[model samples]
Target: MPLNTRILLDNRPRGEASVSNFRIETVETPPLAEGQVLVRHHYLSLDPYMRGRMNDAKSYAEPQPLGEVMIGGTVGEVVESRHPRYAPGDQVVGMGGWQQYSVVDASQPGALRKVDTTHVPLSHYLGAVGMPGVTAWYGLVKIIDPKPGQTVTVSAASGAVGSAVGALAKARGCRVVGIAGGPDKCAYVKDELGFDDCIDYRQHRDYPSLAKALKQACPHGIDGHFENVGGMVLDAVMLRTNPFARMAVCGMIAGYDGQPLPMANPALILINRLRVEGFIVSEHMEVWPEALAELAELVGSGRFRPRETVAHGIESAPEAFLGLLKGRNFGKQLVKLV
Candidate 1:
């Protein structure tokens, strides 16, 4: 059995999350039972949603229990398989957690799906063609359905989900704008990701300044929004929305550390006739096939390129994840387990 190195939640965050919250350990991979497969993970995904799960407070999902392997998405090859459907050497993606190896019960629905690395890189199964891509699809297509010539904007625009949302919306003929942390991120969002305009949120400390920038960038007014960061970003977006605008509230990274994030202006929703909806992509299993197909086409055809920021090993996950929370990571944050 492979010796698995894993990170566990050592303690919940008091205010801001730090590397101290995690603990690392090594253990032997348990014997795979019938219908199980052993996966040696090549990469593990670090996402903002995981931060919310670290808390013991009531949330859409269960809290991360102390002393358990930290939850995360992973893509790897099946080194050993006892299941009829899965085979050794089959590349698969699953919630393999923050570990170098995982034992998956392959019989469970959506537990492990084989992926081809011929066109799309195996790591892409954890990014552009996987959960983040699906998330961007659901938010834009299902919630903030924008029409051609309409202006749409996304926060954390250079990120995994936001970049996908921008690409998907641009393909639909909508003018896309993005909000990012710094000059370099904003540049990537505009130059590389092809957003019409990218605002550097750090340049504007308050909502008023950010709102003015949005007005200049989105002259047509924001018809739809995909919100990843709340607080001032959301406030600015709300102030610039056109009538009957739509918003897909995917995450509120600004308040992930149990901080109270109140809307600055609640009246804007009714006044602007906005439809703001918050969603968890996992709940809408029905849309995965359709979403993944389109996203796969976008990625496989080389139309959309999702960037990644990788940390070298399991021990690097905590610091990498902390940087992600602080908006220090440039793109999709990943831990290279192999």
Candidate 2:
């Protein structure tokens, strides 16, 4: 039996997660059942949504029980396979959790997507070409169909999803404004990604002033809003939304752990005639091929660039996750297990 090190939730986090919340324990890899494959984790995708899984609160997905291996998505290489469909050395992406190895049944819905790393880096399968990239595409193309000359605003603008959205909007001929935490992130969005403007929300004392800044950035009110950090930011954006403006609510990283409360923005939503919709990335998985093609072409042509902030080693996963919640990650955050 293969010995694997896994990070398990030792205690539920109080507000923010720390190393203390996780315990690294060694365990034996379970014997592969029929149609199951054993995989050695190569890369782990550390996302903000995992914060919700750390608690026992009600959410779209179940919370991780104490002593249970923390849930995550990973890119791995199959080491042992009892399943005919998979074989040794096959690289695949799936819900593997924060562990050195995992056993996956091929029949599951999120079993794995086989990857060809000779063309693209295998890590890209867990980053730009994977979940975060897909989220940005579907939210922008399917949900918010930005038109030429329209003003587009993306919160958490320097992160993976935000950057992708801004680049896609710019490619579509729409003026994009990114709202991030600090000057460095703002500069990256404006100067590097070619966003028309960027707002450093941390420098702004009040949401009203932030709203004014956004208004100034957008001489015309925002035509579409990609909400990543909800709460006050959503409230501020809602105050200046154009009529028929669409909002793709991707995440609420602001309230994920600190405080669990519904934001007060319905009055503004009604007044501005905004259409806000919350969607899970999985909801649009079937249509991913089309989005992936466009994104891949843009990437290949150098039109779209993905920024990634990577933390090395499985031991760094907790800190990396906390960094994501604190907006410390510049782009998509990942942990290299190998």
Candidate 3:
């Protein structure tokens, strides 16, 4: 029997997550029951949302159980199968977690799906063409719905979801401004990702400073926004939004540390008459097909180029994930298990 190396959540973090919060162990692979298939994960996605799942608190999803494999999206190949729908060597994408292999049951809805790596790379299914891409599509297309020539802003603009949002907004002929951590990310957001302008949030640590930079970048008041880092960034973007503007609230990474980070200007929501909406991309599964098709096309045609920060081996998953939360990993962060 093959040994399966699994990384489990050892301790819930009091504030920011550390490597000590995780535990890695190897065990003999469990036998697959009827309707189960054995998958060998090649790549595991490390996303910021996983940070929210770490805390034992109320959230959109259940808290990640302690002593279990940390939940995550995995792209893998079926090495063995007892399920009729799956066969040997079939590439798949599923919630395989921080383990080298998973025995997924076919009866689980939306749990396992086959993927074709012929045109798009297998790792992309974990990022651009997968969850993050769909997340960008949902927020921009469904929520913001920016018009051509309108000015739109995105926080954490160099990340996977934000990068996609900027590019898609550009395709729609909108003036896109990105708020990122530093100069290099700002440069990549503007030069490579094609955002109209990029603001380095690090330079402007305070709300007033960020507001000034945003004002300079967006000469015209922002008409739409894709909110990623919620605390200060949201406060800054809100100050410059036009009346009747739309904002899609995606993630509030600042408060993920169990801090009660309040909005500096909640009144702006009312004063600007902004239509702010918060969404989880997974709950809206209806749009995945459409979103994936368009994203795959864009990626395949070179119109949409999604970058990645690859960490080698399953053991690296914990450190890589911690880096993602701190904005250390550029683009999409992934652990290459193979």
Q: Candidates' TM-scores?
A: 0.99, 0.94, 0.98
lDDT of 3 at 38: 92
**CA RMSD for every model?**
0.8, 1.7, 1.1
Q: Lowest-scoring 10 consecutive residues by lDDT in candidate 3?
A: 254-263
Screening candidate 2 with a backbone cut-off below 3 angstroms (N, C-alpha, C), the clashing residue pairs are none
lDDT of 1 by residue, 1-338 (tens): 98999999999999999899999999989998999999999999999999988889999999999999999999999999999998889999999999999999999999999898888999988889999999999999999988999999999999999999999999999999999999999999888888899999999989999999999999989999999999999999999999899999999999998778889988999999999999999999999999999989988998898899999999999999999999988788999987
lDDT of 2: 0.86
Evaluation by TM-score, superior candidate among 1 and 3: 1
- Which segments of candidate 3 are over 4 A away from where they belong? none
Q: What lDDT tens digits, residue by residue, belong to model 2 across residues 1-338?
A: 69998899999988778889999988888998998899999989998888888888888877888988898889989999988889999999898999989988887766877877765677777766788888998899888999999999999998888988998899899999999998999998988889999999987877788888888898999999999988878878887799999999999988887686466667877787788888898877797888777767767677767788889988888888888888888888989888
Candidate 2 lDDT score at position 95: 86
The lDDT of each candidate is 0.94, 0.86, 0.92
The better candidate by TM-score, 2 or 3, is 3
Give per-residue CA lDDT, model 3, range 3-112, as digits (tens): 99999999999888899999999999989899999999999999998999999988999999999999999999999999889999999999999999988887799889
Please count the clashing residue pairs in each candidate, in the order shown.
0, 0, 0
